[model samples]
Structure formats: C-alpha cells, structure tokens
Target: MSADVIADFWPYVMIVVAGWLATDIWRWLGVLAAGRMREDSELLVFVRAIATALVAGVISKLILFPSGALEATPMGLRIAAAATGFVAFLILRQQVILGVIAAEFVLIGGWLLIGA
Candidate 1:
C-alpha cells in the first residue's frame, strides 16, 4: 500500500486499538486476580452485592423512567410484568433466564392487548 493510504487508515487503527485496550485492560487484570480469590471471600461477597444492587437500580430506572417506546407503554403494564417476573423468579428458584422470559412475555402480551 502507498504511504498515503496507510496514513489514512492510521487513525482508525489507533482508535480500535485504544478502545480495545481501554475496555480489556481491566478485564485482563480481573481474570488474573480472580484466580487468587476464593468464591466465598468477603470481598467477593461485597462485590456480588454491589453488582446486584447496580443491576436492580438500572432495571428500576428503566421501568420508572423509560424512554421512547417503553414510555408509550402504560406504567401498570410495566409494573405487572415486573411483578410477574419477580414471582416467576421465586417460583423457579431464582432462574434468571426464565424470569426474564416471563417478564418479556408479559410485556409483549400487554403491548398486544393495548393494540401496539
């Protein structure tokens, strides 16, 4: 390739490499560190709790203050779907996949019911 052609691609190449390094550096360090940590360690327990809380908070924010299409749906439908999912989660012994599927089913059914 000509020097001009290589120069034209250099910025894109650098952007991709920088983005990868930015995200993967921490993941690489985590993998290295994880091997030395016990599953039931206090740090692990706290990390799990924080992760769960963050997930819950994000879901709550989505339901309570949704954007675009979700905002078009009634709040009651959203709440009902969440409640059904919560029940399914408990009934299925905290099976996350099943609970998410149940919630989606409820939300989609509600959308169809309301002619959306």
Candidate 2:
C-alpha cells in the first residue's frame, strides 16, 4: 500500500489490534474455561465479591472526591445523583443502564439548573 494509505489506516488498525489484545484474549480464555466452572463455586463467589467491591469503591471515589468537571459540581448534588441512581436501579428491576441514564440526567440537570 502507499504511504498515504497506510497513514490514513494506521490509527484504525492500531485501535482494532489494541482492543483485541486488551480484551478478546481474556474473553476467549474465559469461554474455554467456563464449561469447567460452577456458578456456585467459592472462587466464583470470591471473584464476584471482589468485582462488586471494586465497583463500589470507584463509585464512592467519584462521589466523594471527584476531579475535573465533576469537581465543579457540589457534593450535595453528587450525592443526590448517586442516590437517585440507586433508587432507579432498585425500582427499575435492577436495570443498570436505566440507572446510569437517570444518574446522568440528574447530574446534568442539576448542573444546568444551578448554572454550575
């Protein structure tokens, strides 16, 4: 291929290769080992708990000690958004996407309302 063509496609090629290298190998390994794993296994339970804790920790950090644009918003607004999202999550049959949407709506709405 010509140099111009390679230059145009290099970023796209790198993105595809990088994405595959980052996630697909682990996914394939998981699929291969899934048949041998039990849902109720202690290892699975521990993994689930660790994953949940990590998510919670991230959420806590974002709410309590935000950075950049988020830091501009008040702590009360942040807490309110998180609470609204959790309530939405529980009320909407645990649909995570809906909860996230609700949270974003609250955060953006509050930010706009207060002219922050």
Candidate 3:
C-alpha cells in the first residue's frame, strides 16, 4: 500500500482503538465481575434501582422541559402519553414493548392533532 493510503487509515485505526479502549475496558471488567456476582443480591438490587431512577429522571427532564422540536409538543400531551403508556404497561402485564408502542402512538397522534 502507498504511504498516503496508510496515512488515511491511521486516524481511523486510532479512532477505533480509542473508542474500544474508552468503552470496552469497563464492559470487560463487568463481564469478569458478573461471573462472581449474585444476581439477586441487595447491592445489585440497589444498583438496578439507581440506574432505573436515573433513566426515569432523564426521560422526565426531556418530556417536561424539552428543546427544539420536542419543545413544540404540548406538556399536557406528553404527560398524558406517559400516563397512558404506564396504564397500558400495567394492563399488558408489564410488557415494555407494548407500553412503548402505546406511548409512541399517543405522542404522534397528539402531535398531529395539535398540529405541532
């Protein structure tokens, strides 16, 4: 290969290695630790709860105080969709996919109805 081709490839190779190092190291460690960790342990339960809370907080933030296109959607519609989805999730025996679909349908339908 010519030097120019190697030069172009060098940055891509560096990016791949950098990205892998940034994410894969922790994932590898998690895999190693998972083998020894109990799935039902209190610590694991607490970790899961914290992770869920963090996700809920982020989603709530986005829905409540969104930017760009999301900001155009009414607050009541967003809240209604979330409430409807939660009810649907409960009704469907906690099937997340169904719940998410219900939520998306509500969001899109509301957006169309409101002409946002």
Candidate 4:
C-alpha cells in the first residue's frame, strides 16, 4: 500500500492490536505467577473469590442502575426482564447467549410499550 494509506491506518491498527494483546498478556502473566502454587492454596482461592465477587457486584449494579434507554422503561418491566433472563439461563442450562437475547427482548418490548 501507499505511504499515505499506511500512515492513515497505523494508529487504528495499533489500537486494535494493543486491545487484543492486553487481556491475554495480563492473563498469561497471572498464570505464570500462580502456576507454581498449590491447587488449594488459600491465597489463590481468595484471589479468585474476590475477583468473582467484584465482577458479580458490578453486574448487579448495572442491572439495578441502568441508564439512558433502559431508564425509559418501568422498574416492573426491568425486574421482569431480569427474572426472565435468569429463568432463560437456567432453562437453557446456563447458555448465556439465550439469556442475553431474552433480556434484550424484554427491554425492547418495554421500551415500545412505554413509547406508545
């Protein structure tokens, strides 16, 4: 390609490459550091528990404090949507994709009703 095209693409390409590498780099570093430890090491187990709990708390907060388009919908509808999504996850044997789709469907349906 021409120098001009290369110049235009370099920043975008670097951003994508950097983003792709970031997660694996950290994960690999963590694995290397922890691999020497015993399977049931208290520190490792505690680290995993803390990480899982932190992620769960963030997820719960998002669902509870939804903003923008989701804010337009009623709390009852939002609650029902979350409940339905959880039910879908359980019914589908924890298939996350189906649960997300069901939840989105509920949100959109609520949005439409509220607008009308």
lDDT comparison, 2 vs 3, better candidate: 2
Which residue pairs does candidate 3 place in steric collision? none
Listed in order, each prediction's TM-score against the native is 0.57, 0.60, 0.59, 0.60
Q: List the candidate 3 regions with Cα displacement exceeding 4 Å.
A: 1-7, 10-18, 33-35, 57-76
**Candidate 2: regions farther than 4 A off:** 33-35, 55-76, 87-105
Q: Cα deviation of 109 in candidate 3 (Å)?
A: 1.6
Candidate 1 displacement at residue 1 in angstroms: 11
Higher-lDDT candidate of 2 and 4:
2
- Candidate 4 residue-wise lDDT, 1-116, digit = tens: 99999999998888777876766887888889887788788988888898899898987777778878666667788878888998999999999999989998997888788883
The C-alpha lDDT values of all candidates are: 0.91, 0.89, 0.88, 0.84
Question: Local error of candidate 4 at 100, Å?
Answer: 1.1
Best by lDDT: 1
Candidate 2's error at 103, in angstroms?
3.8
lDDT of 2 by residue, 1-116 (tens): 99999999999888888886778987787688667678889988887888799899997997989988788899999999999998999999999999999999999999999996
Model 4 scores a TM of: 0.60
- Give lDDT tens digits, candidate 1, residues 20-106: 787899789878877878997999998789889989999898998899889989999999999899899999999999899999999
For each of the candidates, the C-alpha root-mean-square deviation to the true structure, in angstroms, is 4.3, 4.2, 4.1, 4.6
Model 2 / residue 43 / CA error / Å: 1.9
What's the count of clashing pairs in each model shown?
A: 0, 0, 0, 0
